[model samples]
Target: MDATTLALLIGAGLVGGACNAVAGGGTFFTFPALLAAGVPPVAANATSAISIWPGHATSLFGYREELRRHAGRLKSAAPAFVLGSLIGAWLLSVTGNGLFRQLIPWLLLAATVLFAIGPRLRSWIAPTGSGTLPKPVIFLIDLLVAIYGGYFGAGLGILLMAVLTLIGLSDVNEANAVKNALATIVSSLAVAVFIVTGIIAWGPGAAVLAGAVAGGYLGARFARWINPRILRAIIIAVGLGLSWIYF
Candidate 1:
């Protein structure tokens, strides 16, 4: 890759990592940057998936305290997530790219709407959870979300957060922690598939990975320092901006 392309990839990685750490729309930045840098759409998507793995790992580590607190739930949910991700990744590989490309813009729009009204939706669903949701139900939701994550991870965290909220996780921090860990798991598995298929662009992947790690670390730390309302506003703005771009 040329120096200019490398630089753009790195820059996009920084934005992606930070956004992912904070609000989960990093692909909205990195994917476009990759396309602009002349990577084919399918290759760019594959490469971006490989690059963002480190960011997810960093974000999950940053939320280790919250993860520890919910270890039991995570353990219970792991099988579902793993199974779902594998299925999702396999489906993506088997399905032709044409369908995914046609579907993505609409998916982004739907995800954006989900993010925009998620809180209100949570409130509406709040009363249904006076008691815990059955483990089977939770597992099914996890599996479904993991499938979506493996297929086209844009705005996945928001979808996970919504599911978690409906299932009785009222604390945003805890929800975010779970979202990060699950996303990390799904992305890691998906990357493995992409790499095995020889779809990843290693040079750009390495550059983006470096930037994502740094940005994720900083963003997670900054998240702890910021006010929740401000953070929410920023996340919503970023989500809207991404939606516009994708649309």
Candidate 2:
């Protein structure tokens, strides 16, 4: 990679990581940066997943208590999540670049919409005093979310959070805890497939990874000072702009 490409990738990663920590929607930055850096569409998607994987791990660690409290739900959710993720990852490995390119704009727009409406969707879909969804229905919904996460994953957290809310997690922190844990599982399984399929662009992925680690640390230290709503608005704007550009 040229110096310019390297710089772009690292810069995007840094911004993406900070956005993720402060709000959520890091992929809106990192995925576009990879595409602009000249990575092929499928490879860029896979590389972006790899680049953001570590952040999920750290987020999961921060939610250890919530995870423990929801241990039964987590246990029940794991099998479906793993299966869906593997299937989605394998599908990506087989997809041609041309096809993936054609799909990119739509996928981005959908993710953006999902991110934008996430909080409202959670409230509307899982209103207070609503009964919990049946186990099978929850499994099906989670499986679909896992598949999407494995495939592109820009708004995976929002989707996961919505699901957690649907399943009776009214507490924001508790929902976030399960969301982070499930996201880690989705990314880990998808990344393993991407690695085995040799689809990742390691050089650029490494750049993003290093920058994300640094940015995550920085974002954490300054999180209390940051207005998350402002950060979230910025991410929503970026996602909309990128979606329009790709379209």
Candidate 3:
């Protein structure tokens, strides 16, 4: 890759990792950069998933206590989550770059909207008084969320958080814990699929991976001084700008 493309990919990954570490929505940066660097749309999606996913790991570790408490749910939800991810990843692979390219603008827009409305969606969907949802519903929700997570994963956290809250996990931390785990599963499985299919762009992916790691570390270390609201605004603006350009 040319120096400019390398710079773009690394810069996007850095900003994206920081955005995710501070607020969320790292895909808002990396996906657009991948496309600009001439990665095919479907390939870019897979690369983005792997590149941005490391940032979510810290959040998962931070919520291990909550994860332990919800261990039972993970057992029941695993089958559906894994299956959905497989199907979604296969779907994207089959979609090829052409159809996925057409869908990129819309998908990004949807992700932005979902991210923007996450809190409101949680309040609207989740009853104030409720316990963990029934297994059947949990599996169904997990299935759906996993599919989307494997598909693109842009705002999967918000979607997972909303579903977790709606299913009656009252503690925000608890819900986030579950969301992060399932999201990890989804992305992990998707990465496996992408790797097997040889669609992941190694050069860009490596650039993004290195940048994201550094950015995540920096963002977390300095999180106390960072204004998440500003990061959130930056993500929103970038997402909207990419959508406008792509459309």
Candidate 4:
């Protein structure tokens, strides 16, 4: 790759990782960067997944205490994440580029809408006097979200946050911690598939990975200080914008 393409990938990764740490939607940055750098569409999508996977680990470090408190919850959620991710990744491996391309905008729009409605949806699901949703219901939700994350994870964090909230996780940072943990599982499983399928572009993936680690750590540390309302607005706007462009 040329120096310019390398620089672009690194820059995109940095921004993408920080975005994921803050409010999700990182793929809006990384996926397009790869496509612009001349990678094939399927390869770019696979490489994007692998590139951003490590950021969740660094982001998790910033939420260690929260993670500890929620260890059992994460453990219970793991199997669904694993199974769903494998299914999604397998689907991606078999998808033709033309079909995948046609699906992109719709997927982004749906994820964006889900993120926008998440809090309200959670409130509706567990209105006053009602307890948190049942464990089985939560598990089903996580499985569905994990499948999407494995396929195209731009707003996976927000979707996971919604699931965590439905389980009665009130603290934003704590919810983010759980979100990152589950995301790690989803992406790791998907990446393993991508690796086996030989769809990832290692040269670009490495460049993005390097920047993502640093950005992820820093973004996580700063996340708590930011106003959640404003962050969500920015993320929503970005998601809408990206969806529009893709359409």
TM-score of each: 0.91, 0.82, 0.77, 0.93
Ranking by TM-score: 4, 1, 2, 3
**Global lDDT scores for all candidate models:** 0.78, 0.75, 0.72, 0.84
Worst 10 residues of 1 by lDDT: 122-131
List model 3 lDDT by residue over 126-240, tens digit each: 4463444567877887888788878876656555655664666645445545766777788889989989988898889998887887776565555445454654465466566
Error of 4 at 56 (Å): 1.1
CA RMSD of all predictions = 2.0, 3.1, 3.7, 1.6
Of 1 and 2, the candidate ahead on TM-score is 1
What does candidate 1's lDDT look like per residue over 60-165, in tens digits? Answer: 7678899999988788888988988888777777667678788776766666666557656656655564636667777887898888888877777666766776
Could you tell me the lDDT of residue 23 within candidate 1?
76
Per-prediction backbone clash count? 0, 0, 0, 0
Global lDDT for candidate 4? 0.84
Query: Which regions of candidate 4 fall more than 4 Å away from where they truly are?
Result: none
Instruction: Please tell me which predicted candidate would have the highest lDDT against the true structure.
Output: 4
Tens digit of per-residue lDDT, candidate 2, span 43-62: 99899999988776765555
Q: Write the per-residue lDDT of candidate 4 for residues 176-231, one digit (tens) a residue.
A: 78888898899999999999998889998999988888878887898888786776
Model 2 alpha-carbon drift over 4 Å, by segment: 108-130, 217-245
